[model samples]
Target: MTLTKLQKKFAEGIALGMKQGQAARYAGYSEKSADTQAYNNMKNVEILAFADELIEAQKSMLKRRFSGLASIAVDKTIDILQDVDASPQARLNAAKMILDYAGMEEPKQLNVTADVNQSNPFEGLTTDELRKLIDDG
Candidate 1:
């Protein structure tokens, strides 16, 4: 459901952390009715949904901004790693940061399972037999 301009303003104010009465006032509600309007608006499903949407949009924007900053930090670390005049310890730290950020600091472990009942096609073949089989194939 589309919200009216006042309802949208109330939702935005709430999303900005204003109290309901304050949000109602911000939405242009009269001073005498601000509290009553706020109480009523709180029960409005459309306003609540719009407030939630605003919060999610804010979260998404922050994530994108933080990611951009992280990329710049990684790039500066790369520069430190390549600087000839950087101290050995500093360069080592930078290299370690790059590796950690790239998720290469710890080696990944994998598990392999086999079915005991499965037959091995070449299990009984001798080396010369394997060679002939390969040649024929």
Candidate 2:
């Protein structure tokens, strides 16, 4: 079976992570380490295959009532991105990174706020701090 575009992107992420000796944590499994070294060592084609299934699993999980797993997956994706070395133009890459993780088409608009709303109680917090708060809440 052929890999889709999203599958290709996911496979590339795994390959990059493996090359850097960084473990990819997905669905509570470490893509690195002795237990999962084989998975981490998968080639592009193999990873593409694995990613196809993983994406399907994530979609199914999202359809259920569980609201928290999706956020955990996003956090894991972000951690993976940070562990990998991207080019200097990280902003452009961030958008692609997010879409690739979510296995979705490009969004018409992203609702992210660049600056804090002064009216918000935690408006003074940095983006990093805000992200933590949002994730924790």
Q: Pick by TM-score: which candidate is best?
A: 1
Q: Candidate 2 lDDT (Cα, whole model)?
A: 0.57
Candidate 2 residues 58-90, lDDT tens each? 677678856677788677657655754665466
- Candidate 2 Cα misplacement greater than 4 A, ranges: 1-20, 24-42, 66-137
TM-score of structure candidate 2: 0.22
Best by lDDT: 1
The Cα RMSD in angstroms, rounded to one decimal, for candidate 2 relative to the true structure is: 25.0
- Model 1 clashing residue pairs (backbone): none
Q: What is the lDDT of residue 108 in candidate 2?
A: 81
Local error of candidate 2 at 131, Å? Answer: 73
RMSD of each: 9.4, 25.0
Candidate 2 displacement at residue 120 in angstroms: 59
